[model samples]
Target: MDPPEQLALREVFTAACRAQRAEVLATAVRRFASAILTNLAARPVADLLADYFKPVALYAICELVGIPATQRAVVAESAETMAASMDGVLDPERRAAAIGSRTALSRVVDSCLRSSDGSGVLGHVARNHRRLDVPRSVLVHSFRLLLSPGYMSVATAAANAFVALRAHNLPLTCLSRDTGVDELLRYCGPVQALGRLCRSDFDFRGTPVRKGELVLALLGAANRDPERFPGADDIRLDRRPNPHLAFGWGTHSCLGTSTARLVLSAAFGRLADQFPAAELVSEPRYAVRAVVRAPEALPVRLTRGSEGAIR
Candidate 1:
């Protein structure tokens, strides 16, 4: 993506956040949680992620971007294909698929912008595109970015948070306090690590680093470091003064931190409240991706008569 495109995309999110357009994100969270309940109706329990969260996240993203339901599957497939290329481990066939999907996704996003159902972040951007002077390609790239990480991260984070809550057997009320949520975010480390290029020579403890070298900050390890966080190995529900960098730190920290927290808290909080007896039927099967890590399957047995049935 070119600088202009990047800037325009940045503006879209920054502007949306500035306008306090969190209601859309909140609705998406509720819809995601409801999907889990819907799946439970068919089966006593299902893969919390694959069976429910994935589809819900995909649908919620489309809803957020004004992508019509009719075109959602195609758009979603394209976005997924494109995202698979991000870890830079694509074979020739996969590379070709990524390129093709990028083309298709760009076209689909262009169509949506032209005739949006007229709502959500995309709608706001479309209405202000001329004012922002953002190019069609820029908007398309932005949509792709939003659809992939913007959706996947929140869904995966919520699932992981629930897993932590289950492991610790903590109550939903714990998450009501900000400290509880912070510890959850720290313990989960959804993004895992961030790669940074050294601009100048630096020394670490005893080892020396050269300029222009790539270094991966292992956020998950850091968050679990006992030195920084006492009893870090244990999931302290109300771990306070937590300086965990789950959302990354410094200049390029995640822009969606607040939104992500709200989504996770709302989703998991409801799950805990509704299915207090929900128990894991099997171990979580995680995706093998190194860059962004989350469980592919989280099988759980839910209580038969849960209060918060999807209405």
Candidate 2:
């Protein structure tokens, strides 16, 4: 990477840390938390917990990437259809949503770039984008990157942790507090897998990996690597020096990762506080998909909990 590129990334990182990234994530967290709470307060029997995590994550991602309101639905729809197409449900709505989302996201990013003021990530990314002459593909790439956090891995991790919590007679309420969320992320593998494309020839152990090939980094596998963690499968909430790779490493590292952690911390903290006695009544099933693999749908009865109105 050139010095200019390095400088650009550094600037963006600095700007991201300056509150834009945190703000975007906090906004998302608030929306998601409110959505769930509203549902709880209004509905009588609310239990499609994991599924509820998806749309909030999706909409938040759109806003973060500056996906134009005109095309936000399309981008969301297209991405969903693209995923579903592999499963044989290529609906026309998804196609339209995708195409529109891409277009809108592209335009909004452009507007953001032209207005750079070191004031917002939008302007910062725009200034750097123009300086770098970023391509349209980056818009799609960024959208995809931001899309996963709220609903997919982060939510799955929460669900899986919920399962583990119940199986061990642990309280879901503990998660709502600030205690043990980081350990939960480390132990549960919030992001089940991460991917990399070889930019240069490099050797993995003994095998030579040439440029332009896909490399799958199994975060779940690495987190469980015995040499790295003793009794790898065990969950030790007090575990330290974790060195877990729930978030990828290097330049292309996940931009929203810290933000994801914050959102999760808040959500789980609330869960711990609100439903201290909730219990799971069904066997949780896991799902596997390209790039991300883990539980897709988590169902629970909330069998025993505070006498709060659950939506």
Each prediction's TM-score versus the true structure: 0.79, 0.72
Q: Per-residue lDDT tens digits of candidate 1, residues 130-161?
A: 86665567668767766666567666776787
Tell me which residue pairs clash in candidate 1: none
lDDT of each: 0.69, 0.56
Q: Candidate 2's C-alpha lDDT?
A: 0.56
Writing each residue's lDDT as its tens digit, candidate 2 over 175-263 gives: 54333565566667655554567879988899999998988777777878889887777766666667777766666556766655665
Candidate 1 stretches greater than 4 Å from native: 1-12, 23-32, 35-39, 90-96, 131-136, 172-177, 198-212, 304-311
